[model samples]
Target: MNAIEIINISKTYKSKTKTITALNNISLEIKEGELFGLIGPDGAGKSSLFRILATVLLPDVGSAKILNYDVIKNFKNIRKLIGYMPGRFSLYQDLSVEENLKFFATIFETTIEENYDLISDIYKQIEPFKNRRAGKLSGGMKQKLALSCALIHKPKILLLDEPTTGVDPVSRKEFWEILKKLKSQGITILVSTPYMDEANLCDRIALIQNGKILDVDLPENIVNKFDKDIFSVASDNMFLLLNDLRNYSHTLSCFAFGDSHHLVIERNKADENLLIQYLSRHKNLSVKKIEPTIEDCFMQMLQSEN
Candidate 1:
């Protein structure tokens, strides 16, 4: 069964002098019990789409349904069935961690004790600091507390928007582990993130940018779709090597990737020997064929669109 259905959803924000389209004819269906991800950078309409699903914001030109309930007409029912954690930490900062959790549980007409098992794995980590004010806790601790409150009502669907942004790498890993546990219990999870590596952690992902969806598929499948030869090239003069590679006749595209530059060349038009000879002036020059990553595919898609 599809837990969420969105059809031709478009939202635009208009000011006196300008209008910005947040979502552009977006349509997607998320199956029940699936862990789906929306992958994109900031200002990509991720939060806007999430808000529409959470029933807090309405689309200007389309319809959405959650668990067979129309988002606009059955908002109350949808609100009760889903848990939403916005990109920002929204819990009352002045309240103690325990108080925040209890407050959310009360709003849903349920006690934390009733759904303690659902959140125990996450809550226990922050339990030692239950009396601490929410604003005083560390970033990772704040994340755990927010998640505990979201799950306190035993929601059927979870909408987490960029939950790991600005968090430590270790905490990010731990949080994803908790998500896997939640998925096993049959909760449909929809999470958005700017991290490309995190895409592999999801069952499926939608690559969104500029209020538009670039592609939607499994992580491996998306990587497989990149049908170009890419080579990792490095030289002592990194800056000069980038410009030199881009100017080469066979070069299709080139971008800096950490210590090396990923250079895409026209099929059968260029080889390592030819590149080596061309850049022989630079010291420690090296080139090797490599596989494409999720970010590589995303950049390829963006290049195609342009």
Candidate 2:
């Protein structure tokens, strides 16, 4: 059976004259043991979906099942079957790392030692300062502790919403490593994040924006599906150069990526030689063809969504 199944799930909030729809008939199925990712930026409904799966909220329309338990009607049972880590650090900060773990375990009427081995690898990293108050810990250590608390009960499914958003680079890598370790223990994980790079870490991903799923596929496969060719253009006047490129009818899409802007052209009509001479009219500039990447695909996806 699918670990999680969401069919035509839709949610909205209302206040006087304003009604904001958070999810728009979103549907997906995640197989057991798959590390599924709901990829999107802030306010794109990633957290809303996670909250619904975690049983903290109800969908206004449609249904969601976790392990065959309806998220709305069987919310209590569903809560006991999964662990959730919200986008923000919602753990009890005044409590020590060890205390927080104990608190969560106590909520489920279980002890940490009962499932010590399940979170042992992760707990070890935070064992040294186990007595330190959670609020005093750095971003990375706090994340580790939260993961430990979530895993203490060995829930069948893990729901993480933007878990690594504010953490440093090293910590982000470490956090993902911890997740992979959890995945190996026969647990299904549903993680959401805005980072395009993290899409490759999941077994499958649903790229979402404006409460809509643009596509669902492996990261590499999604990148390979870019219909238009791409090129990289950089110049001393990069800002002005991008504006000029965007004005051209031949340019399908253009977005700045680090030191270069990935440019999609309609056809060979705007090839390197043509672009070079056209760009030469401006100040110091360079243009070269380049392969498309996940970020490029995401950019194109966002463009199409608009």
Candidate 3:
């Protein structure tokens, strides 16, 4: 059986004056022991979908099943088999690190000693701060504690929502390492993040936006789908250069990427000389053809949709 199965699932929130759709006709199947990523920004329905699978919310249409157990009908069974870590730190701020872990263990009728091997790698990092109140711990320390508690019961599937957001670069790297180790132990992981760079770390990723899925594929395959010559164009006056390039006849698309702007043009329109002559009319610009990254592909997809 698939680790998780979602069929035509959709969710919407209604209020006094307006209605908002959080998820729209989404369907996906995650393989057993696969690391799947939901890549998107805030309000992309990631949280809504996650809450549904976690059995905390219900979808307006369709159904979801975890390990062959229906989310709606067998929520308790599903809950027992999955470890869910919300985006925010939901642990008790007044409690010590050890106390928080013990509390969750008690809820699941499990002891830290019973699952120590499952969380030893992560729990070891925060053991030094066991006496510190959860509120007093650093961002990374809190993240470790949360993950340890989530895995305390040795659930088969792990659902982490934006676990690395607001974390330092080093901490993010360390967190992904921990995930890699867990995957080796035969656990299915479904993680969500807004960072495009993290998409490649997953076995497969689905790019989501406006409650809709733009594309779902392996990261390299997604990059290869970008079928255009991309060029990095920048000049002394960046603002004017952006405007000039946008108005240029051969410029198919242009968007600011980091310190330089990435521009896409038709196959035959990839002429450096022509681009230089066209942009020099406004300002002296430097241009070079560049490889398209996941972010570039995401932008291209969004542009095509518009």
* lDDT, candidate 2, 99-188, per-residue tens: 999999999999999999999998999999989999999999999888888888889999988999999999999988888988888999
TM-score of 1: 0.98
Clashes of each: 0, 0, 0
Error of 1 at 284 (Å): 1.6
The number of the candidate with the highest lDDT is: 1
Candidate 2: pairs in clash: none
Give residue 26's lDDT in candidate 3 (0 to 100). Answer: 93
Residues 162-222, candidate 3: write the lDDT tens digits: 9999999999999999999999999999999999999999999999998889998999999
By how many angstroms RMSD does model 1 differ from the true structure? 1.0
List candidate 1 stretches off by more than 4 Å. Answer: none
Residue-by-residue lDDT tens digits, candidate 1, 111-204:
9899999999999999999999999999999999999988999999999999999999999999999999999999999999999999999999
In order, the Cα lDDT scores of the candidates are 0.93, 0.88, 0.93
Residue runs of model 2 more than 4 Å from their true location after superposition: 267-269
How far off is residue 11 in model 3, in Å? 0.3
Give the poorly placed runs of model 3, Cα more than 4 Å off. Answer: 281-284
Worst 10 residues of 1 by lDDT: 265-274
